[model samples]
Target: MKHAPRLTALLLTLALLAGLLPAASAAAPQPAEPRIAADSAIVIDYDTGETLYEKDADTMRVPASMTKVMTAYIIFEELEAGNLTLDTLVPISDFAAQISRNQARYPTAVPLPYGGSLTVDTLLRLILIPSASASCVAMAEYISGTEAAFVQRMNATAQRLGMTAQYQNCHGAHVHYLTARSQAILVREFIRRFPQILDYTSATSATFNGTTYPNTNQLLPGLAFEYEGADGFKTGTINAAGYCLSATAKRDGRRIISVVMHSDNNTTRHTDSTALLDYGFARLAADAPYTDTAFHWSWQAVEELDALGAELHPSGEQFRPEQAVTRAEFTAMLYSALAADGQLPPLPGPEESTQPAETAPPEDTAGEPEQPAPEPEPPFADIDGHWAQAYIEEAAALGLVEGDQYGRFNPDSALTRQDMMVLVDNFVELPEANGLGFDDDGDIALWALEAAARTTAAGLFGGSGGRLFPSASATRAEAAQVVSRVLELA
Candidate 1:
């Protein structure tokens, strides 16, 4: 009997040790280090001012058009101080038009005929969006009466922002030198003081005087290589500078700024920037403590859900954390969350066409009978009489959801993690996933990679046992937690 007891104790000890080994090994998987084709690159966390990654960040190089970022910063400051207004019309001088003619070299210039009038807002858009050198001069002259005088203000502003750079002109057309570190600093402050610059930089195309000019930065909407959350910043290239880009993106609640200078080519500049952003996000995730503790995780999620007014279950008294969520249910939950956050647009009221009282005919035709308007068709085939009909319609209208190829909205089907990511991305701007590769990246569908990478970086989703179960069904509890987080952030 003594021998039997000793053997049993040894077997239990072995089993416990065996279980510990896998967990210990899986505790902290190392993230891949980022590499860039640029001669200089830097990535920083916007919230914490932490340097997530850098490569020769302080080496001086020709900044090219990126100098306009600083110029716009000054312009925004003046606007905020009430010294300049968006509607202030600036006269395009002969000198400005002549310099703008240098567009043959840059190919991003908007025509600025001498004596043509443009609002300050239009000129700023031309400078930031299309990289028109003439607009830079016009803005400088409008602010300081001459480009030389404007260059003085640029230098002064750069000094105030702690940017150690040599400026040779109002626009970045001359031999001006700026380090990646200095450029990032200038851009960070620009965004911090005037976050609305993103509205201009994020534009894929801007129209002035009926002529539409495409933005030089290709990482925006309607571009060849649009990154999900890329909103603002700039891109530049000169023979001497090669190619350069300063980019910023926000995901979840975290924002990252990346600068890549002296890339070998235009494609390489964008690629390097994307890689740096991925590395920054990966580092943030790796540094954060594991948030998957059993009871604590559930409790935290419950608090958010309660605050967001999320219902636990339809009939069950206990919250069934493992129950899968259907498409209709998830859409309703997301719609409710957006409504609670006041993020949804105002609903359209009854129009004159729909209301006979508002469209009453004159007294001479008062006796004529009013014809009833035909009912509009529902957006989805299967959602016509569904309980979640309104939610599905609103979601579809906002481009948040799409029906199957056969035009049938399968409302009862379970929602997959990949599908959820795609839906969430339509509402929230997601970060690029260039450098962050998962162990099971092959399992992710081609269409879902961008959303998965973004949601992962935002800390909204994570893989199970080092594998992202892209096709796995999302449970009701998980849906509640995600919706709550989105609302809280909003």
Candidate 2:
């Protein structure tokens, strides 16, 4: 009996040891968490094919106007191959002209008559800035001698990038036959091909014939005017495809290209893209060698202030450019600089809050219970702050937050969750928030709650157990961490 028990104990010991040994051997170092900036987003090193971060990156959804990225790719290749030039003028074909008139599914043309002449550069500008379907068709015809052939080239290029699922029509309208997986593959392939598209995407707006065409990606201003290290790419929208954007930004010698598909609208797209860009610039490194200072760019700052200005110096001293800025005040500084630089247009007059007044309660009578005072709002200053400062100040200037009546930035004030949610609410205009299952969604006071939920669902912010602690104060670390977490979720 003693021998039998000993043998049983030895067998159990052997089995336990065997199980642990494999687990120990297979254990590898945990990989660093990926940081992403948008829902269904991706950041790729412009030079290398390495993916820095991804969220539903390979999930195929309609790319809407992002199809222009591939279109721009072909155009750029044509330019590089001497088939097209910035100044080269091309006649609009009947097919291209017809597509531009397509108000049914794509952006309508600006009454460019058939056979009207436009330069290749001008066409590029149109497609890139406002995502004109007419320009896309014209460029397609210009490249492949016909839209059919141009699509063939686009698909071939997609195949080269290992995007097996994407197929192109003259415009990026949905093909009933392709799976979402295929569409994503094609989009990813295009990204892999010309990472340089990001430079163009980051551009705030472009000028043609003395008229400035702003980027459909509104984050440009949201991040601040003439954002340093910012360039250009494009934006896309189709009712079926939702709102989409591909953005590229460079900072500290690192450039990241991010794509957001099926955003609810341009505002969501910008927030998502800004989140991704923030993460990439703050975290990742480019494969090519460079230093942090190379990514830095300058924005002009003015010291003047009124209701929207308070320069928060540690010792109440005059403002210094090198001092760290809070995300809120930094937005103001960037706008100030943009105004100085002539990048942003003149400011608009004070209007009632952009928030839905219908949702607000009627003013209380003197005898009634006192209503809570509304939070203060920021001045929409269009000055300049470079890169990081630009994003911060831009957020402020947009009335995404209320800055102190004085111009000083209180960088260390903890951001209340309600405040952050309110900032997000102010940032976007969404459809009515009801039947989404949150009671707060129906209330006017929870506007930020509604906005935050929408953004969160779009993968901009990861919710905590489906609840946003709106009353909690947000720390800088918490803010960055949340932003980073949201980037990863995106």
- Compare the candidates by lDDT and give the number of the best one: 1
Cα deviation at 384, candidate 2, in Å, is 56
For each candidate, what is the lDDT?
0.74, 0.52
Q: Each prediction's TM-score against the native?
A: 0.55, 0.47
Report the alpha-carbon TM-score of model 2 versus the true structure.
0.47
- lDDT of prediction 1: 0.74
lDDT of 1 by residue, 335-383 (tens): 6566555575544333347544657655676768998966666667898
Off by over 4 Å in 2: 1-39, 173-203, 206-212, 221-228, 285-490
Candidate 1 ranges with C-alpha deviation above 4 Å: 1-30, 104-107, 291-490
Model 2 per-residue lDDT tens digits across residues 123-238: 87777776777787777777777777988887787777666445567556543122223343444454556555555655566675566766776656454323445565566677
Report lDDT (Cα) of residue 193, candidate 1: 82
Model 2, position 483, has a per-residue lDDT of 34
